[model samples]
Target: MNEPAAPAAPETLEVPVAALRPSLEAVLMVADQPLDSVSLASVVGHPVETVVAALQLLAEEYDEQDRGFELRHVAGGWRYYTREAYAAVVEQLVLEGQQARLTQAALETLAVVAYQQPVSRARVSAVRGVNVDGVMRTLLTRGLVQEAGQDAETGANLYRTTRYFLERIGVSSLDELPELAPYLPEMDDLEDELERVGGLPRTPDAVQDHPAVEPMTDSQETP
Candidate 1:
């Protein structure tokens, strides 16, 4: 008997480095969402370091070639996306007629939310000098702000910027917010306003008390 055809040697599967890089790139490119380094490593059957190195190399290659896309770390993971330079073109094509633009009022309300986050709608309205009920709703629907929690005293809803806000602003954290000194009024004007208001009340020496201001709700209409 012909030695049973010598049990066909187990097929050896070899993945080339060049092919592996593109394979990884394709996976990241087509993914509908970001993929963590660990997940990518597992899928590629390689170490996390190897996956990261590959990602960096791919990013560099794209940059060197002036590709319209590159790898980005966003929302706690990595993904391939087009460069911002082509945002207008891509947005026009992808969004088509479905894109919604923010009104000036909405932008102002959003600014208030970004700087004084965890703030109530009342405070935001107070600062903007307009009813923010509709604007806040729009921002919420657009995923820019979210309800953080209710205030203990008034049970009013507190609002804060969402991760979408950070991503849109291209900031990794709130601390990266640009300084607003140039836009703000002078300290003397603020002090003068405080003086005009007969100065803020000072706490008693023994009983340190906090005011029971009503919690601000993003949903409430300015009455």
Candidate 2:
């Protein structure tokens, strides 16, 4: 009849607009790690410059409002952190929960990993005088430790503390770890123990004496 009314003009294709700032907040609220601006721009459907300016504005607003948490640029991305004034409150709560949740053995095993990183579970067991397979698994599950690499000789997986580990302990780098680290078994001592236990010897330079990458300082605390 009337040329089918010209296909009804496609109904204007209404697309609901998402509010920029609230959208940014929603995405950041659930992020476990810092998110870079470019990644954020893609997710929020905004230009990179716009997204970055919005983030800076939000951070400033939070600071002006004296919010309990603040947005910070760290580790090449943006993340939220507890306000410095309220850190002790958060720290006490976190520490109390940690005390109840992590067992004495788990704590001990974690300490071993933190100080003797790039070490194997077998080496941990050798130092603790007990099998650490189960405890090491728990640490890995909690995101406190990660696999570094495999032993060149024995082919066993080496373990190390994660950046998250440094964050929890309020340290920026492994060098900030307490003096007790020196008191732990040295690499040579551990190697000798491995030899006694019938494990193959590792090359002199197979594992690094320090963390391969120093963890960046988080917003709230530092060593």
Candidate 3:
């Protein structure tokens, strides 16, 4: 009686294994955002404690090696960013002539995109309590925001902050944005999102006279 080889042990059981630090680096390299230790552990099939230790060790190694990029923690996760010492070169190479600072409205929209990414334009507008169509268009044109994909339920295109957003902001990850980040609503809660945006300083026309809205500089660097 041949038992068909136990169905090859089912596909889900197979897990990829590799050296810890390299594995972490490989995943972080392509990640659009930082990854928490447990998340990294799951991907690398290691214990969370071991992954955390490895991340610290790797950070030390980069510091010793004077690597152009370094492993960093931000936005409640681990990710990589170019070392600040090299920021000048990277800015020259990557940024070049593109120099337009973010407007208060754009900055608000970007913040919304950062916190509630993979979010829809309608959702963003609903949160901002204004027609964000024009602001979103500006974000798209500026390359600070990108299309993440479509929502399964709504089929509306979802937006996420781009790597350029991280770069310009000089953050290793979204976690580095600031401590206030924890206050942002979780990405899935629409009612909370609406309430969250509604809580922001409103002017009957959403974008005016808001405290978070900083004055745009004269140069207008395309941040």
Candidate 4:
């Protein structure tokens, strides 16, 4: 007697190109990163040109509808982002929502990272006058801050604010960040804290003397 026939592989669903908008929306809604047309085409099992056109149509529809969310092709891929006009309302909702409330420490740490980035943890702690490891972890979990790389001399991990942070704060670029002089800790305070903290370089000149990866400017940064 022969063994039972092996189970057949599950059939892949072919999303019809003509009807791909909703399917694309559903996947893009759940995606953690921007998706390019080629990747989306593979997912929908359609031709690249067809998927590209479908994505463009969906984007245009969202624009025409003036929806709270819009599909955008950014950083060479497609993703759903909150419409800029409604950012303030979304921010309020997220902030008021129990799970999204960022503590004062986290906020301070985030600000330091935002302004001083590709900055190291020691530098951040120095600026905040407290150990920032925990706060950094929280920011990382929230997708607000990411490790850029290591410091050249000290080899400490360098962190930078993410585009998500800019979106949450409703800024197109760091230049759009509100007058940093008022909201962020004073330079004197950072210097004093750096003195007390006594680990990372004590001044900008020192930090600049040696560097690892180049810091990304808002223009160069991907969302």
Candidate 3, residues 1-223, lDDT tens digits: the string is 8666555554442222337767888899878578998899999888887788788878888999999999899999998999999988987865543575667877887887888787877666656656566677777767788898987866777899988889988987887767654775554463444445544433334332222212222333322
Clashing pairs in 2: none
lDDT of each: 0.71, 0.73, 0.71, 0.74
Model 4, 95-192: lDDT tens digits are: 66426678788888788788888898766665555666667776876789898988777888789998888888888998887776676467666555
* Candidate 1 stretches greater than 4 Å from native: 1-98, 188-223
As a whole number from 0 to 100, the lDDT of residue 21 in candidate 2 is 72
Better lDDT candidate (1, 4) = 4
Worst 10 residues of 1 by lDDT: 205-214
lDDT of 2 by residue, 1-223 (tens): 5555554455442222236777888888867579999999899998887788788878998999999999998898888888999989988876665545677788898998888788887667655556666677667767789989887877777889999989988999999988894665787876565444434345445333321221222231110
Model 4: lDDT to the true structure: 0.74
lDDT of 3: 0.71
Pick the lDDT winner. Answer: 4
RMSD (Å) of each candidate, 1 decimal: 15.1, 12.5, 15.7, 13.4
Reference-based TM-score, model 3: 0.42
Q: Which stretches of candidate 2 lie over 4 Å from their true place?
A: 1-18, 102-223
Collision pairs in model 4: none
* Candidate structures ordered by TM-score, highest first: 4, 1, 3, 2
User: Which candidate, 2 or 4, would have the higher TM-score against the true structure?
Assistant: 4
TM-score between candidate 1 and the true structure: 0.44
The numbered model that scores best in TM-score is 4
User: Which scores better on lDDT, 2 or 3?
Assistant: 2
